[model samples]
Target: MDKQRENLTAADKKSEEIIEDKRAVQIADPSKNSVAGKDTELAASQVGYQDLFDNMPNGCVYYKVLLDEAEDPVDLVYIKVNSAYGRNIGRSLSELIGKRVTAVFQELTGEGFPCMETYLNVALLGEPVNFTQYFDQQDKWYSISAYSPQPGYVVEISEDITEQTKAEGERRERERQVALIERVASLGALAAGVAHEINQPLQALKIMADSMIYWYDKGKETSVEKVIESCRKISVQAGYITSIVEWMQDSVNKAWSDAPEEVDVKKMIQRVLILVQERLRAHGIQLRENSCDNSLMVWGDSRRLEEIVIIILVNAIDSFVCVDQGAREIRITTSCVEERAVIEISNNGPAIPDDIIGKIFEPFFSSSKSGTKLGMGLAIVKSVVNAHNGTIQVFSSNQQVTFRIEFPQYRQSV
Candidate 1:
């Protein structure tokens, strides 16, 4: 028994010596030790990364790109996916892992697999891509970010943005409603001017018809030339009345459109002047217009551009209510400078208060004491101008208030 115990002790000592020699070699050979340490660290890092990826709030997917004969990436093979990814896509790990992307998104074949080109570029070219996509099958919107993890491999992260998209759409709809209401209110304020405009042509038609009937009833011989002249005059007045009514109807009923066209600034100003001229004359406000003889063109909706002029003109007309009628003057000028179309509308009515000028374009901000105005006209004007990539500024000094608007000059593409 003593001999066996000695042998056992010798064996144990031999093993201990062997272990110590290996430790000494590792310490002496720093490179070997470093390599071994790096391997351990790499393994630990991979495990940690896997844990983080699986636990990320956003969905994450890993794919291995499959190439064709031309070395062009043709399809992606699902290698790994986090729980969040499966949840977001409404699929199980069993359904995705070890499966081709085409098999999983067979329904999207009609659309050529959404972002297939984008994904392949990321995997093969190492170019990262970020984009938003709407998944019809899932009825959701997602913001996806994809980048190459290594050659021929990509990792994608996705965040659901359906609610955000819906909210933005709803907000735009609400703005459109508010803008429509403001336009109707503006037309209401111009009702008197519009009535006067229609009445003048109507009164002419009545006078011409009355003369013709009087000639016929008095037993006076009516010459063919006189009858033709009266008919021509009546036709002109009727056409004029039709044009005014048509313009008003279009203004009230036109829907907002995104398509833009080249708008002649001079013609637009003339049309708006026709609508407001009677109002200006009724208020004894003198109008001075200095427009370029050459056509000044801008790229935007004609109706919205017309609205901008009308809003400014109406504000100018209202400004005269507190001033003596004889001193009221409004000036409008259009010019082109530095590849920009510039419009300046100035009024000599009481200058906008220094404190209120800055806030005039803000929605629902009014300086009027009547409490009947919602003050959305200038706000809508600013919004429309910005939508057209234009700038508007106000200057008030020396008993004058001027609104200067600038838009990029329309240039025909070559």
Candidate 2:
């Protein structure tokens, strides 16, 4: 009798708990509530969500990811959005809440919205994604984070990054200005050296002309061979002057305008070699070429590409001057790696110490001679590479410093 009473007591308690659970479910269900109760609960839930949506500092949006027959997200319908979101997109909640994303912004589909595509993927796949978007139409930038709470819904948190982008652009412009100033300063320093270089050939020409005139005036039979040799000397010297002037002009003009096209990589390197060859020879530095392929090509501004090669070569040339008396040599090699064009320019000068190697590409960082302190060459090289969607790196070992640059391969259109 005592055991039966204990079992009965337990059964009664379990039944009462089940009844309480049902009542709780009923209270949560609006359909099970009285009309007034249903309205009150629904209003409370909406107020809670509204308070959360309005309190965020950044723009907040909830979208229903619309799907086609194939179950791919075809478009997005704005379900709920805060005031900040509406203000960001130049629309009000009343105007956008029921509208489709594609209907409002056609450019999104025409060009593409990689960021939005990722957001829809997150909603469909139940993952989270973060990306930056540049809206060309509104000239705004946004840092967005998106995640899905349900199968067909996405919540996006966005912050306007237009100011940040503007600041970055301003910084780049300032760097460009600094680079220009440094380039001008380098030209100023080289002016005397270049004049001296030109003077040597000029003096030689004067001597040759004087000798020819003197021989003719003395009634000496000037052989045709001698006259032809003097003429050839004059032509060579004149050609040298023309080449120097052309190189200088091209270097300056390329900085102002950059138009990209398919460029022959090997041919462009040879052009830079022509410009710097005399300087290298004057310094007793020997140049060795290896692994070069004539057919290698890249899509870029040829003149700008030449500038990149020139900067690296000139830097190597400068290093040779500062090194202790030894065999000065520069090795230029090129190869294709994973469909990317790779060029390695290495010099057996002094090794750049490990501590400063990383900073070599930083703006205004130079290890060059005193009074030539504008260290913007490598900085400019890096900027140009980044603009071209390429990469550059430096390595130093055993008194050898090398700069390795890689560029995307260009394929010709059929």
Candidate 3:
């Protein structure tokens, strides 16, 4: 019994000695057991975080806010940006890190753009901002989400929406074209003028034929010179009819081509005026022009540009006829500004209400209650201007309105 107790004590001592030896080893090299392993674990965690960041579907940009003397966020430096963010900015990821936001996108820092202010708000106030914005220069749409993860730091996530926006625009354009055709079909006033114009040329041709028949009936000696002259007159009148018919056919067909060429601005305007002048006169609307040099040119489709002018003129004429209160007058002026050609069409008619002015260029937007109204004319005009890399704006006040269109002047490549 005493020998068994002694053996149990020795076993207990052996277990204690083993534990003590392990404790000593840990004390001698603590890093191998805890600190070193912890470092390895931390490194693996960092690599995971980096991998997650790099593979994120949406564009991600991390910014460190630079503050003013008042501790207000004045600017932001790109601390880190993912590959998607670099592509969205049309730059390399290596080129963007450490760059300032102002240096990266100068337009955003300007007064008209709200991106800089929105970012600053998130950074300084720790507020989250989520919105969709169209970047005109980039010609893209982005669904942006920004939030401050820490003081003076902001993270922005962006998803590209360009394809979605383009799809919507294409759908709207198709609807607008259909509505335009329906509206034109309903315009009896314009239809009557077109018919009258077509008939005049036909009537003249008939009169010349009748004169030839009379000469033959009386057996009068027809000189070859006179016959040739009569034939020439008939040809001219027939050509006029053909031109008017072709114009109507093309307008109704709505065939648009992407091929662009050097277009004489003055000649295009004259062609449009020829189409609309009679209609304007029938409506008692006087047209006046403060001419610019005919030498000014633009790079675009002449037919499309003429269509834009026609839409604006028709809209103006309709307003004049609708209001029927003031002197129905449209004044046109053209000039060159820097590298752009500017055309201004002003009318002394009913002023467009301030509330709806911004909506005028939107598809299917119209304030007029006329049955013939399509509300797509100005929208088409805006689309055409954008296609030509041009800009259009409206100013209205005191029963007067002006549409100003500016196009990049076409210069021949040397």
Candidate 4:
């Protein structure tokens, strides 16, 4: 019995040795141990990537391209989405994943969502695109960037920009309000010139009416032709007066509201000159309109353009306060240069000091010696020009100060 126990123990030892040899082989072969380690590391790496995707602040989505019978992408299938994506769309992952985009947002079907075309291009072409979209259903704006990560798969990252868009809109509205205020101020400054322009016609009308009244009251003989001519003159004067009042009213009412249109530069300049002519004469300043092209045209609000001309003209007029009236001259020229309409208004007044020229367009910066002006005129002028996609420059030399303005020439589309 003892011999039998010893043999059994030896057999058990041999079996244990065989198991240890197998374990040693497994450790010595990289294919077994290293492969297991590699698989564990790969699983950990995938988990880490998933964690990062879920934690991203911006909404992230992975989409699989859905193709029509023609092999053109028609819609997208949500393959995967991060937590922020669910928060952005107000949907859970269970509701979004494996769902078609059209089914998720039914209103986006057909041509309603133009962004689908951009997405399709990105997915099929493996390109990247960025765009901003406003969703009426959500009442929000999103700035989205999308790129294809692989064939038939695209990744999109989106940020909510609704607040930013609203802020920008509010900023624009405030600017418009400020511009309106400046326009009113400009009109106030030109009130005297406008009144003078209206008065000339009023005086002519008075004379014509008085002549007709005197002929009838004094028993003076007059031909029917003479009476008819007097009536015609009276009508003409009345029309002129009406024109002036209407022009002023239009300027005040549509300073900031009117849509851009083709404006005749020469006709506009001529009309402005009519209003300021009396003032120029009063100051003994010679107004010279040189090289004004009748066909010169620009695209802008005529009232605002008129305001620009008037402001610069007023500034030029004020520059002559200390200047010798006999030597004062204001020259206006309009021409086309390099597909641009150029207006040059120069005055032979005191030159703008070198230190002040740069700040002329700044709000509340005035070069006037009297210091009574609000100094918003040139600032408003700069704003108006910029709003119209135009430019204005000033140069002064040899007792001559010139305001050079350029606007893109209006081209009628064929």
Candidate 5:
């Protein structure tokens, strides 16, 4: 209400100025009666235009859009807006009428109005705004529009956009929470499997390094082959631990990591499979592969990809371990399609329950009787897949369950 009162006061002052100017011109041109009449007509015309603007019901953001030399692009500054726009921004029309709309609303949007910026972007391209934005501070929303009234004049209208965005934010949060819960649960159930996975590689590395150390101490290490072999074993062991830690870490944060490096999919898969090979052998799960990328070069951190594959494999292995299932088997095959590299991990266990299939990636949502999992393995798998700009889908039938992942080829220069 205070803002509106200020606008009224300013409008009155402007009208008085127009009247005084007209009177001055009339007195000066009295010797030429026709010229004095023309001045009177012009003043009367401006009065109606100003009156219409002052009486409008809501906020108005009519602005003169400035364009570039090509006239196809709009500049983000120096645009003309109106009195109502000033009120919406808690400023006076007199101070805001000739300023750019972007400058005024930039602070209103929390992060600056992406919607308005987008609107202006389109408007500058000789298009118009037909959207609404909800302003939290003013407890209202706005419907906005823009047009090129003249060569550089962009007239805009903004009506109040509040209800819809709030609903959207609420909806997204609900989905995020649910997903986090299910994934954590899956991770919990797979705890035993993951431990065994890391331990196997460590065990091998320990054995190989120990043997190398014993030979060296006995002074029977006559050949350089012994030292080289021991160093190789220790290297392999450290490599395995590093890989697992990297993958798990990447899933939990959004930090900016360096660009994706070359991934030797075949060798890494074999090494990862080695980590879990004991579990696979114990469960009688068979493994097969065809590295069609020849290099199977994926465009992401190797360890991160390993985590994704490991999680899926662990979940499948867990499903079969349940007492209700009889035929236990999981197989992974790799392939390359155009710019994409794919890995398909399939298993034959009891068919997943219809009720639980879709919600599998949701956090704390578990079918594990072990009570260890909070159900996060598949959820992490999904996150890793998404981060890579890849896709993951599951298919199930009476006899088989298949999880397919497609990734952009690292060699393809994405």
Candidate 6:
């Protein structure tokens, strides 16, 4: 019921991908196909249309509406379904197509009743709904969406979000419980200095509050001045809380957000190097860029984008294996083509195996045999990049590995 829970409840959920699919649908009028040299007969064939919808890679559903005695939208019947939909829920089209909405969905929920209420509202209103709700009994994250194209029936689609959700949850939990503890311990080491600095502000606020209370108690018909002073004291306290929360949120989302923002492309490359300055110094890696042009601007979160560069560069530094390997160098270059910024970062390291390039983006995949390879760093980077509407590729040959990332400058975010 709190704000964050409410946010999760109202999130894009499974519909984010569904919405993207909707955008990809190029529905054309069957009537115009003949003149356009299109398959007019194929266009008019409802069976073919239904078959195509059913055969789609993703689960698809089509529901029919049936009204009640009161002329209100009351029932739902699945008029069409794809094989994926049936397989996901372990139900045949015949079993689900004619069932009442409440009857079929009522028992599948974890919280039982609350989820049912959410469904009923969507069914009655004839609107599409999306949320990251869980079916407690199923114990998995689902990107779920319910749509009612007509007055009385609802169509629903669900996608498993477990892997991505679990990764994010684990990352967040570690930051909250583990990383914060480390940060707090570090703060504790500076506790005396922090306390002494904080006490000054606390004392100032308290003195103002006390003076305001005295004035308000005295014979002032309307204590506007005192009220303002008290409000100012409250602001000071709220400021402290805001600072802590902002610091935490910046550390969290700046490093990783489900969605990435398009950045000024020319600036972002330089910015990435700035982020890895300490690492470059520590590893003795000489970094160079081919072009320092001012024209390109790519799309994506600079923070997460920079993380990818840092991870790859760190691996490049590690590839030296010995400090005596003459000079460790990483070269980065970028070009813009058809408004897409193509960034290439390459290192002169041992060649990556031909088989390994395909699996690098897979979660928990690593080339390193050491215990230190958590295996998810690159996976997170790829996920973050993908969510930004970009693509990443790797090419490896003798003594070199190249990561080529293409970022399109969306005039308006899609």
Give the local distance difference test score of model 5. Answer: 0.69
Q: Write the per-residue lDDT of candidate 3 for residues 158-255, one digit (tens) a residue.
A: 99999998999999888677646543543332354457666766778899999999999999989999999999998987776777678877655544
Candidate 1 lDDT by residue in tens digits, 1-414: 999999999999999999999999988998999999999999999999989988998998999999899988899988999999899877888889988898778843334568788999888779898899998877899999999979999999999999999999999989778766666765664565567777877788899889888988999999999889989988977776787788878777664544578998989999989777656877899999998766788998887788788888888888888889898999999999898999999999887878899899998899989897778778888987997899999999868999999999998889
What local lDDT does model 4 show for residue 309?
A: 93
Global CA lDDT computed for model 2: 0.80
Residue-level error in angstroms, candidate 2, position 49: 22
Query: lDDT of each structure?
Result: 0.85, 0.80, 0.80, 0.85, 0.69, 0.64
lDDT tens per residue, model 2, 171-210: 9889778656655644543444455456656777899999
Best by TM-score: 1
Task: Write model 4 residue lDDT over 1-414, tens digit each, in one string.
Answer: 999999999999999999998789887885887888899999999999999999989899999999999998899999999998898778999999998887777633333445778898998888798889887777789999999988999899999999999999999899888767877877775675577667767777788888888888999989999989988888977776776788888987797684778998888888888666656777788998787434888888988898789889877887788888888999998888998989999999888889988999998788666776677788888988998899999999977899999999898899
Q: Each candidate: RMSD to true structure?
A: 4.6, 10.4, 16.4, 5.7, 14.7, 25.8
Total backbone collisions for each predicted model: 0, 0, 0, 0, 36, 4
Best model per lDDT: 1
Ranking by lDDT: 1, 4, 3, 2, 5, 6
Write down the worst ten-residue block by lDDT for model 6: 185-194
Candidate 4 colliding pairs: none
Cα deviation at 200, candidate 3, in Å, is 8.5
Q: After superposition, how far is residue 409 of candidate 1 from its true place, in Å?
A: 5.7
lDDT for each residue of candidate 5 in 302-388, tens digit (9 for 90 to 100):
656776777787778777765343357677888878868888888887788888789887755778787866666777778768878
Each candidate's TM vs. the true structure?
0.76, 0.53, 0.46, 0.71, 0.51, 0.40
| Tens digits of per-residue lDDT for model 6, 172-232 | 8875564344333323322332233345455667877776667669964546775776787
Better of 3 and 5 by TM-score: 5
As a whole number from 0 to 100, the lDDT of residue 50 in candidate 2 is 80
